[model samples]
Target: MRNWLKIVIFLSICLPLSGTADEKSGDHSKYVRHVEQGFSAIFRGDNQTAISEFETALAIEPDHSEILHYLGMAYAQEQFWNKAADSYQRSLALMPDNIEALYSLGVVYFKLDKWADAVPVLEQVVELSPHHARGQEMLGKTLLKLRRYGDAAPALMEALTLKPQAAGTYQELGTAYLNLKEYTKAIENFQKALAFGPGRYAEPHYGLGMAYLRLGDREKSRAEMQIYQQLQKEFAEYERLARLTRAEPNNLEAWSGLASLLMSQKNYPEAVQVFQRCIELAPNNANFHHGLSRTFMALNYPKHAAEAAEKAVQLMPDQSILYNTLGSAYAMQGKRREALVTFQKAIELDSEQPYYHLNVSKLYQSFGNQKLAQEHYRAYEHLLSEQKAKQK
Candidate 1:
């Protein structure tokens, strides 16, 4: 319970029959030994070794329910949810009443985000093993994901009854209460979760903030939101130094980090402001100009984007990406001649860039240059086909 990551529910296997000296075929003891080794591997977090040992056990007894279940647990440990689901399905086919297999299969489906599939399998788990806290918790979480707040509330409450100290259960129940518009209950559960859970857990803080807002406690809501933001700022690697940028305005790295974080969060206008500040400090930084151009384009200010992109191109004439951005900005502004020349320049710099060819093809098509359009279009198709083949 202390290590939440130790969540996999593994199937326990019995050793081979003691008096099987004369009834053995191809060494049944060896299969049992491999299963034991697989179990050891799983305990040590060596999932690949566990997979191999389980696979060896399966080779001896292909229809083995226990071996299939062990292999599924190994796959689940490796985050191979699809393979884990398949292995559990095979195990279930051999032994339908196997609670371990049912629970594992449901957990795998949950991992795959197949909430509908998970619901029935997990429902059966709680039905058979009514006091199974983990099963109840998973079912509650899945139902919450599916927006079945009414059903989730009961299951989460039952899970809390089964495991009174579980912070995650409290957090999930808080979410359910929030969705049901029980603001007081939501705030209570969220506070309980924050009290018991790790300090870095941001979700409960966010939930508490929402609950406070709903209750018209604006000051408390703002306080909780500030805590949530501070937690997020600490957890995100790139955004860690964002606040430092305000104190040390000349720190280009801090400003760049903040700008990148804003850009990734799609706060394009804020990112543009940050990049402008960065450019003011370091005018020759080509990447900053390029970032500003991209942010401007994201904001659909093509003319401003073109000016910023042209500066980036001027600073780094050989960079294909700057030309591509400049060309796209030109195309957006209906400067067909300039866009065609720039797109062609980008292709000449890096013919392997598929987008450059695609843009040129579009530009040609716009001007009725049928021959050039066909040539570039064929090139773009060929590059895309090659990329797909490489992926395979």
Candidate 2:
């Protein structure tokens, strides 16, 4: 009877314990698998897939803080601010001391324009990790947004100490000083910002203009304000073009205009990217390839320029401008004979284009063919004179 009781106890305790352990192990494995897949999708910029995988992982491990944080990142990437905030909040609830979650929550609040809400969370972030430059910077900006200039100044100063070359931070700090009626300090910070970004950013110029105006330096203020106005106009146009592209991704005209604008701004790298995107949208369009070639040339990537220009010529053989661009690329690459041939082709396609004749003339000059060079040069001069007469 005792032996029977012992067997019963063993079966009841050991069998159930073994089954529970196996079930837990299986659940853990499944949760990890889903989490891994979620991260992989996020790395590939597939936020929807990442969100789905993270949601599945969350279902399996409902209280996992790290998983919640990752889900928040995917949501943030999709610009679902509220959803991202909720995920971060939930993650922080499970791990209240998590500095990353706190910082992320603060950033989301800032994005949502919840300046009041962002303050305490960012405060917590800095409190937990005093050396976190980005957290300090965001906190300072949030404080500035709230118009707490006094509090913002020191925070921003600390941020600057951590990251001395931050142009935006300098701009924000200058604004803080301007609000505090410290015109000289504001000017100094604004100048520092301009030193970093120059013509690429507008806010520092505007702030400098304001500070100069306060100091009764009307001449300097006017100059600075004029530049600010021009920069603002360019920024507005950029925003308009950006919105158009977002609204109509396949609009070749919009893409081309944006790429052209970037090139005009001397943002060669960004122009290259936009031109590449234009090519992706319309692979057979020679203009996009030509634009890319020009951008690559501006960047001094002669090999890349040659390749892109070659593609453009192949796509639109009859286009004289494509041949001219290819010739320019070949010239840059020291392929003098190829460049001469290509430039001659451009002139043959459109004899009225003075630049084509000019290019061929230069190539002939390089080859010591003085007679041909002078002949082409005269043709270039004649065509240019005709163009000028038409303009008149």
Among all candidates shown, the one with the greatest lDDT:
2
In model 1, the Cα lDDT at residue 199 comes to 48
> What would the per-residue lDDT of candidate 1 be over residues 31-145, giving only the tens digit for each residue?
8899899999999999999999999988877799988998998999899889899999999999998888999998888888899999999999999999999999999999999
lDDT of 2 at 290: 92
TM-score of each: 0.55, 0.82
Candidate 1: worst-modelled 10 consecutive residues by lDDT: 7-16
**lDDT (0-100) at residue 244 of candidate 1?**
83
Question: How displaced is residue 181 in candidate 2, in Å?
Answer: 1.7
RMSD of candidates 1 onward, in order = 23.2, 3.7
Cand. 1 TM to true fold: 0.55
Least well predicted 10-residue stretch by lDDT in candidate 2 = 196-205
The whole-model lDDT of each prediction reads 0.91, 0.94
In candidate 2, how many Å is residue 16 off?
Answer: 2.1
lDDT of 2 by residue, 167-280 (tens): 889999999999999999999999999998646788888999999999999999999999999989998999999999999998888889999899889999889889998999
